[model samples]
Target: MKNASRRQVLQGAIASAIIIGFNPAMRSWVTSASAASEFESLPPLDGILYTDSATRNAAADDFGHLVRRYPSAVLKPGSVEDIVRIVRFARSHKLKVAARGQAHSTYGQPLIEAGIVIDMSSLDTIHTMNAEGAEVDAGVLWSQLLLASLERQLTPPVLTDYIELSVGGTLAVGGIGGRSHRYGVQVDNVLSLQVVTGAGNLETCSRSQNRDLFEAVLAGLGQCGIIVRATVRLIPSAQNSRVFLLFYNDLAALTHDQRWLIAQKRFDYVEGQVVPDASGGWRYMLEAASFYTPPDEPDNSSLLAGLSYTQGTQQIEDKSYFDFANRLAPTVAFLKESGVWFYPHPWLDLFVPATAVDRFVGEIVSDLTLADTGQGPVLLYPVPTDRLRLPLFRVPDEAVVFLFAILRTAPPDASAIAKMLADNRTFFERNRDTGGYRYPIDAVPFSQADWRQHFYPVWGRLVSAKRRYDPDNLLTPSQGIF
Candidate 1:
């Protein structure tokens, strides 16, 4: 009894010291104090804490290059225990905390101003793997996990097009990829998650236990808890994949073929995009992949039997499964070398109902010129509605839905940003009229009212969950939902 009482007293004293050191009003005092001394009074852990200008500046912005919110300190937790200690310290001191996993977010969704930013990348450890699934640290990238799984002749069921993204980052935002039609989104493939709640409780939740937290944290937008680790479902890895690129001049024809292919399960992977044509018009490109061994490779005639694509406008290639998944790595390298990779990416991702996809595409693409879209990609693909079951991830009421992504790279000028924002708004309004939902992964400045309207039926559940998990509302303030 005496020892417990002593521990309580010590914890109280430490909490009081942290409150004073982290107080926003005492900014000057903190700056003047020795960086070492300022943090010495807080909890002791194995992680590294950086309060320097350079470290803070690096954590200020994300892929969007729009919002730059300075954090008070950047933390690289050495282990899961270190994360728990840091979150507990922040909870006791009333300091907001946000997790940064590669900072791939195009919006300021992961940025936390005047608070602590927990860098999750330091905890990249793959714990174990088996025939059923793999258990890995949240900071592990999909690419890393894929390689590890491949060694065991297994691979994750769903992977984003860019495998370089962190596992927790993609799961938090409902990771979707070319194979999502067969499996589901990455979140749908998760078996369990280890989360550090706002109250500093390190809890493991799954569908059968702590069900609410599991659902909320899947696409919860980091409002409830920070996912420290996850159990990802895996399947047998294919030896090779055959890729076919089909081109079409008419939008309806392309979509018709996509619908037919997906419904028939004729392809292991399916996706399509719109690009500028040499004749000053837009062209649709349908990409499909079939997994097989060299002996079982499908011929072009059989694969392209009845698609509505122009003859002789097809490119077929046989690539190893690993090579096919990592195909976009070269494109990213070129973008970086060309100096446009770091530009303002006012990207927009939308989910339109299958019934309304035709009208939405025709209207948006017909009104824009090649210059307006810049050199980015106009990604359009179809995904089934029933695959996703998260309430917070709003979707249209249809059997099928289309993911329309306008990944635009804009100049750093204010006027250019304004024009992109206007175009996004125009498309957003059109999507709203057609019963579509904003994917919320890209850059779009939305008000609280707009968010409420976007999440009409689930708004109450979200608020209640936030109250139960993060009662102080101290997590992910940049989302601006609360």
Candidate 2:
């Protein structure tokens, strides 16, 4: 399916080894200032710098599990001007800059060892919030934004599973959760973006504005520039929401029904997750809910043709809008408080090609059941790829697909982390051979050579965009884009 591997990567080694074009003098200066530390001598910004390991480690980021990215300085920019100044200094000296939002990245991809980290988490100002739209700073968390919107009886059109994540953070990588089936992705709802490019230029991006930067920044994973502000499209808050769970013993049945619902466009939000079975298999937990009607009325009434909405399960809770958005908060908080959150996440997520979904799952179910994965669940859902049905995401073609992932947390111990690292390597190997993969602002151990092959037909476009916005390659070096 995919071309190349860890061993086979050397085939492109010779072409990669030759830097076909370069200005030698400029390149020399770039090398000298690449790790610039003169920020200590520079004027103060609007926020604070956090160098302490424990403080930086405590951040609720996806890649906290990556042990290697302990950065030298963490700057919590308090204002857009602060980000501007920081970018200016970094660009002048060719220093690496990473915009840290929720740090929900599973790999230490967001963390840059011995580099400067602009903690967008400090610019918590909410610029605007109304039925028409809302504008927020980079550091504003989704939770706070929702609460603010509700005060005005307005809510953003689309949001992620974990609202505590910063708007800029999720927008950079195409945020999607249960609601994505209908609204597209968190990025799709974005109306505008205030960005500071790698070269220290501040610009506003939108369809009518700098549209190229806007598209690249959407699900671009902080590669092009730092998103210091975003204008999110909003709709009237749903009055009430009814959440229901459908349990499935069979994976095939689960996927078939899930695909059908996505194609049929029957629900507002739809997703399926898996938990371990006592028999060591997995139980698929699916739910489809909406606020259009009262809570008692069943949400499952032939959303799909064959599957029974319920083998007849009873009604669950009809939650408030805020409650439904944070249904998983308590459990996530419990895990965080218990130190389970610190463990590395050796996660593998992929978009299985429509034609091979059945064969793909069949081959791996046993290994997943037996694998000693840490805490977290295996997430599996079949999503519609028809262009008109789901407009927010960027799929290569109109092909039905499965969004599959193994989510887990690694322990603090070096040995345990190592085990997880190894497991991830093995898992990536298994998937790459299938030519079925894609990553969005996640930890990517896969090499640059391999990554190109992963993108395949779109690889050229991705590379062109990367070179255009990040010519000097100063933004998010931790992602290893160069």
Candidate 3:
């Protein structure tokens, strides 16, 4: 008799929810007696839980177009409180949960099968801004923040090459950029964060408060907690930027000049690329930028004084600060129009120790053909190891490390993708043997043991934090870390 009464209550709640705007398509999942019983007891939400096929399909894949995992339900949270409520409900029901922001990960890092996916983009809000920094919701894109900051002649010290990425998304992965040589990665410049732990607790953390959680959540791969809000450090912006494009015929000359440029602080921004030549081979291009205000223009001759780039091939261009920061926007638009953006991207990003970068990259590129690269840019640049602060943003143990990225775009054919993935694995093993570490934004396949090895020395601390913060192990199961 008691069981029958409870069932009546459950059915009544389901009916009431439907009448109050719950998605009718949810019947597919709620039809199960056990699922209906558990969902009926869910707490009231400010947001709507969507089970419509269209919404589910949109959340199923990401930028890479590599992996897809559809969830049973998607929650577009109207408020941070909705996240807390849904997470608590998921914990009690033993449902896996993942937070999706921009869905830019090359792999299905933010995906969960038959679980709840929190559409964090709904929480877009830039709450406050001043000379010091801006406090923004997790879903706020870096491009949005940059525009807002530029209005006051300020900008974040560090920004990813692609500013369309969400702040929370990049912070979770340790955002890197050309300016990283001086200011470090984006996570290092963060002042504080507001996170939702897996146990349904809302906490404020920083270097001085809840230090452990602060460290873990930054570049934590969404394992311990979900970053909802952040206060990122900003600096005064310059009015103009002078960009120099120098060509190099030899790899050693390019890397040597890059090292010298960073060591001497000769440019405000520094990066390099391996570009395919007209002769069906590859050459190097070193892109460096200098920021300045009017009447204080950069002395081009002085900046290029000691460099060994090909003398006759140097090109100089000037752009507004905003234009310089958003240089990739046009290329991205072209990619989308050409339909290349929809292809599978099996990118491989590694941090090779300075000692081994030349040999490592040389061997790999020597045999790399245009088909192997898939008509994408190969980026190679150096960063000082000491500048990286977070423990989880692992790097090779050396004075400097080079960021080697093969941003490959594979054909839709299954065989082509398999070939690229296999190549990535081989390169990853080679990188690992030389004490290099992956940047995690790539599509390299990793197993449980691989993940454990990736987080060595600090693996125990991460495990402890996972136990303490997300005791049920319900957060971000797609990462396969814990």
RMSD of candidate 2 to the true fold? Answer: 10.4
TM-score of 2: 0.83
lDDT of 2 at 406: 71
Candidate 2 at residue 70, lDDT?
Answer: 54
List, residue by residue over 339-359, the lDDT tens digit for candidate 2.
Answer: 776667767667676667667
Model 2 Cα shift for residue 64 (angstroms): 3.5
What would the per-residue lDDT of candidate 3 be over residues 89-200, giving only the tens digit for each residue? 7887778899999998988998888888998887878999999999999999999999999999999999899999998899989999999999989999999999999999
Clash pairs, model 1 backbone: none
Q: lDDT order of candidates, best first?
A: 3, 1, 2
For model 1, the superposed segments whose C-alpha errors exceed 4 Å read: 1-40
- Candidate with the larger lDDT of 2 and 3: 3
Greater-lDDT candidate between 1 and 3: 3
Find the candidate with the highest lDDT and give its number.
Answer: 3
How close is every model to the real structure, measured as TM-score?
Answer: 0.93, 0.83, 0.93
The stretch of ten residues in a row with the least summed lDDT in candidate 1 is 15-24
Worst 10 residues of 2 by lDDT: 15-24
Ranking by TM-score: 3, 1, 2
